[model samples]
Target: MDKIINWGILGCGNIANKFATDLQTVSGSVLRAVAAQDLDRAQNFAKKHTVERAYSNYTTLVNNPDLDVIYVATTHNFHYEHAALCLAANKAVLCEKPICVNAQEARKLVELSREKDIFLMEAMWTRFLPAVIRLKKDLDSGIIGTPQLVQADFGITKPQEAGSRFYENKLAAGALLDLGIYTINFANIVFGSHPERISGYAQFTNQGVDQLSTYNLLYSEGRQALLSAAVALPTPHQARIYGDKGRIVIDDFYHPQQYQIILNGKKPQQVDEIFDGFGYLYEAREVQQCLLGGKTESMICSLDETVAIMQVMDDLRKQWGLRYPNEN
Candidate 1:
């Protein structure tokens, strides 16, 4: 029999709800506990997901001996602290994207997880999707040859408001961390190293948060990646990779529904995979599988990869003079 990993959620937000629903789609995993700042919210989430325990305080939830892993679904700014707490309790953690506000904090979390011998992974869920897996296989098979240029973009329109996290610097709200990390990580996965050069620009909110940004990265091997993210407009969320022999295009790349591989002077072939509810099931299953295998980090999203992605974001921020209060 497969070991059933007990799962705990540290936030009751929309992302947490998606993860809870996906947990139901996979075996060898159970949603056991949930924590939220508000008691009623926590209770509601727990009851909705048939979770066994609910707490208004995170510390109480982390101390639960039954939980095998804690999913840190908090906002970008809170990921590091929440993940650190779970690690301190000797529990595995799957933190949401942009694992920390900066590379320094991400490095700290990685070190602590290694020191404590606890599993910790950034929840860059896209990397685990079937479509992405297929893409990686296509690259490895030499169908695309050596990738030379990769492009990806994600954007969404948001209302300008002082309290809106997308426009608030205090919340670490910005296109770079919120949306661009997806493209950056995608590039890293395909390119297999940090870019040799990074240059970018952004449009800032009245409060100094990035509303939109575009980045260009140059690699030592003469490769390049063009990436963009925005919270002020809507885009197709598409991605494409150009290699020496062929190219691959992912429609709606961030949450792709379909993709195509094109070879020189050959017809474009379609590659597609249908996802179960919410597409979060893949990452949840990954965590369960890793725990059952007694692994400390996911092969799909290792700590090294997480840190490398953060380094890219940190460098871009420094170039653009973007800083959150917590960064100081």
Candidate 2:
């Protein structure tokens, strides 16, 4: 029988709640503990999730020897600090997306994880979804026949309040990090290569963070991706992949349940997938398998890929004159 993997969560925020709830669906895994800055919040989350323990401090949570891995679900600005803390404690980590504010921090965390020889992965849940698996398999099978141009967008209409995490520059609030990463990762999945040239534009909030942004990624041989993300602006949240011989469309590329495939001289086909527990359990299961296999990282969402994606975002932010509070 496989050893049951124990889990802990750092930071009891909205994303944390989703992850905790979905974690219950992962087989051979247990939510051993959770921690938040506030004692009350931690206790409440623990109770809601039926977790074994809760602590007000992250250090206490990370030091819990029973936990095999910890998920860092804090805001963007705190990911590097929290993930690094876990790694320092010799705890495996599954950090939230956009892993760090910049590539520099991501590289450092990657180095530390390697040094520790502990499992670590960016919780890119989409990469583990059955739909995405099917999509990749179909693409590799030449169903799309040489994807040429990709168009994708992710946007959420949030109120422009500086106090909210969505608009707070201190929290590293920006559409590029929060929503745009989805579009960027989608392009990465389709192309399986980094863009040779990246150009971007953004609309900034009063707090100096991007309210909305668009990126154009030019790959070799004229392949390209046009993508956008927003906090204030509304978009269709759609994605399209155009190839020399066919095309595919996804209604919600971020967490798609269905997509349409249209090929030249062939009838259009629709693919649909169903998943339980908010789609996060897939990544959680990946973490469990990596730990069980004694692997330090997941190839599907490798640390190198995470760092590379952060570099792309860093370049786009630099071009837009956007910098978080901690950057040089």
Candidate 3:
């Protein structure tokens, strides 16, 4: 049996808590430590997870010799620096979504991971879910032949507060990066290529952050994707793909609890798959498998895919006039 990977968490946030809980469900993984900007926060997270070490500073956590991998659960703008620190310390990294603020930062991280010969993967948990895996299989099987259109949407009602990260321009918080990334990723999976022409518009909050947006992605092959996201409304969070022979509709697609496939005007077929431990288990298993096989990146969500996704995000931001403070 291979040795278990000791995971260190940077940023004791809600996502980090979910990851830690899911880590317990994977066999060859263990949460060894955590770090937060506040000492009390780190200690509290460590206590909750029963981890051995907690550091108030991320640098100290990255330098811990006992850790085999570091999960960067920091905000979008900080992903680059935190992931880079872990990679520089010769530790593998599993970073949260929107891997970096833009394509430039994502490309740099990919390059550094290669030069350092360390494992690194974006934590796009939705892709690893069982429903999504099955959806990919159905697409490959041509159940949906020559996909023509892909539609997806995600949204949430968040209160507008100046200090809240969701409405803060300095934190790179917006409907596009937070909610739209999921819709865009789903579209990319169905289309299998970056859109040749991308256009979008957004409604911004008083704080200069986008509160809602809609995007239209047109591919060279004549396929189109209509994606929408919002921070002030409740969307189905569903997706649909239309093809020549049939169609597949993913209910709650981003984190689907159930889905159905309709073929050539026939009856709908339902798919039911239950997830265990907050749905982060699948990604954890992927990380364990990658480490055991000595691979530098996940084939499913490779560095190239992450960079491509970020490029789409950058283009959308350009259209909406959204810019992070760090970019200036």
Candidate 4:
């Protein structure tokens, strides 16, 4: 327990690379191993990141007793299965966003993590970003008094191609799960509650996945959040929270480093946050701190919250008549 905490990565994808790169920035962490379904990709990632071990199979990586925790960075479909594997092995997990394709799977993973007495958290990295930290504080302090409405948009234009990951039903690919979740999470962060009434619509691709999803969420007392996301168009990747007293605006909010506060009668004041890397070190540090403190869940991104977000996605998908192969 005195030595640095050993970490293992369960996917060798691009997101895993970013996590590995930032893991080095934290003082009490070490990337002990890396794994992928593809052995060659695993070895290459290990070599590039200078990890100590690489494995083609995820179970082998999780079974390693030296590892203190594992990061689940695989595609959406694999998140619940991989995280459950790690927890069953009595290893802690920091699974990537959305937790799973559906709330049922997410809840099962959470239950297993609790049953195994190991840590589990959704890697909702945006919550741990420097700018968001300040934003949370201001909101809590009533800088934005009684948030009445919130708005956010995330859209990326991609060439429509059959079986593309963004529109492939087999992969659980859809604008709602991939991009809309961010906007949903942002609303949750601001309102600190789930929407009571959920209504949304999605434009489906030929593959039967959501190409563009837009919706309005109604919280308690008629408070609302307007959210939109698309894979076929470019929209502002920004968020705004409006309260009686003022509003907070954040651009590129998912990994934001700066945000603005505009009061009712005052000029806009900007708050800039400084970070060394892509700003993932904050969450990496959070994992280390939780392990060191013997905590099983993250305060920043709880298991319940992850499941709630997935439930919203499920409802949205249902509203659009979109269903993945496995779900059927």
Candidate 5:
């Protein structure tokens, strides 16, 4: 019999709800409990997700002996702290992307996870999608001769509300953290390494958040990636990987359901991945596999890779002179 992996969710937010919903789709995972700052909100979320318990205190959820793991679905600013708390409790963690606000905290979390002998992975869901998995296998099989470039953009039009995390610098709100990281991860996967040089610019909102941003990554051997993200606009959310022999195009790349590989002198080979409910299941399944296998880190998205990715973002933020209020 498969060991059931009970999960405790920290932060009953939108992403947390999606995760809880997706838990129903995984074979060995169950949403045992959820925690939010507001007790009433936590109870309501538990009722909505049919979870057995809710807590207003995060530590209580983390220390729940029944849960095998904890998913940190909080805002960017709280990822490090909340994930640290869970790790201290000897709980496995699947933190949402960006992992933390910057690379420094990312390093701390990675080190702590190792010291505690606990599982830890940045929930970079794009890396685990079926289309993405097939894409990697094809790329490795030389379908696209040599990946030369990657291009992608994720943009959404959100209101500039003052207290909203998307527009608050103190809360680490910005297109770069919320959206651009997807493009960065796409580039990293295509190139298989960090860019040699990074150049970028951004349009900042009056609230001190990036409204829209574009960046260029220069790699060795003249390889490159161009990407963009915006919070006040809507883009096609498309991605394209240009190779020496062909190109792969992904529509709605971040949460892609379909992709096509256009090879030289051949019809476009396309693939459509159909799945039930939210796409978060793939990552959740990865966590389940890791726990079942007694693994402390994800093979698909390793902690070293998360730190490297965070370092890239840190470098970019340093160049742009973008510092959150929490960071000195």
Candidate 6:
């Protein structure tokens, strides 16, 4: 019989709800509990998701021995704290993307996860999507020859209301963290390595958060990536990989459902993928497999790579002279 993996959500926010909805789609997965700062909100989420338990305090949820793992779905600012709390309790963690605000906190979490001998992975859902998986496989198969460049952009139009997490520095709100991460990670998967040199420019809001940003990365062997992200604006949200022999284009790379490969002297070949729910089940399934197999981390999205990705963002923030309220 397949062993059930019980999950406790560390935050009852919008993302948590989406994750919970998708978790139900994976076999042998249970939405055991959920926790939020407010008791009323936790109860509401619990009722909505049919979660077994709900807690107002985070510590209580992390300490629940029945939970085999915890998904830290909190805001960017509290990711480190909430993930660390779950890790310290010896619970496997699937943290939301950007893992932490910067590289320093990411490193600490990586070290702690290793010390605890628990599973840890950044929920870079793009990495586990069927379209992305095929894209990487096709690239490795040499169908595209040598990839020379990658281009991707992600942006959203959010209302710039007071205290909105999309525009508040205190909430660690910014396009780079909230939206740009998809573009940067897409480049990482295409290049198979972090950039050797990073240069970027950012336009900030009056709240001192990045409103729009663009980054150019130089990888080894002269490979390059041109990426951009923005909030309060709309972008193409497309991704393209250029190689000597051909190129592949994904209409919505971050949550892609299809991609087309255009090879030299050949017709464009298109591949389509379909999945149920919000497409988050792939990552959750990975976590379930890892736990059942006694694996401590995902090779597709390793803790080391998570830290490296964080470092890349840190370098970009340094270049742009951007820092959140909690950073030194």
**Number of the predicted model whose lDDT against the real structure is largest:** 2
Every model's Cα RMSD, please? 1.1, 0.9, 1.1, 1.3, 1.1, 1.0
The per-model lDDT (C-alpha) reads 0.90, 0.92, 0.90, 0.89, 0.90, 0.92
lDDT of 5 by residue, 125-146 (tens): 9899988887788888888899
Q: Write the per-residue lDDT of candidate 2 for residues 1-328, one digit (tens) a residue.
A: 9999999999999999998899898889999999999999999999999988999999999999999999999988999999999999999999998799999999999999999898889988999998888898888888889999999998889987647888999999989999999998999999998888999999999999998999999988989999999999889999999998889999888888889999988898999987777999999999999999999999999988899899999999999999999788
lDDT tens digits by residue: candidate 3, 1-328: 7988999999999899999998988998999999999999999999999999999999999999999999999888799999999999999999998899999999999999999999999999998999888888888889879899999989889888766768888888989999899998898887777788999999998889789999999987789999999998888888999999888898888888678889997999998877788999899899999998999999888889889989998998988778998684
Give residue 88's error in model 6 in angstroms: 1.4
lDDT of 2 at 255: 85
Candidate 6 clashes between residue pairs 3 or more apart in a chain or in different chains: none
Error of 4 at 164 (Å): 3.1
Decide which is better by TM-score, 2 or 3.
Answer: 2
lDDT of 4 by residue, 1-109 (tens): 4568899999898889998999988998999999999999999999999998999999899999999999999888888889999998999999987688898899899
Model 5 alpha-carbon miss at residue 153, Å: 0.9
User: What global local distance difference test value does model 3 have?
Assistant: 0.90
Quick one: RMSD of model 1? 1.1
Model 2 vs. true fold: TM? 0.98
TM-scores for all candidates: the values are 0.97, 0.98, 0.98, 0.97, 0.97, 0.98
lDDT of 6 by residue, 1-328 (tens): 9899999999888899899999999999999999999999999999998988999999999999999999999889988998999998899999998799999999999999888899999999999998889889999998899899999999889999998888999888899998888888899999899889999999999999899999999999999999999997898899999999989999989989999999988999989986668999999999999999999999999888888878888898998889997788
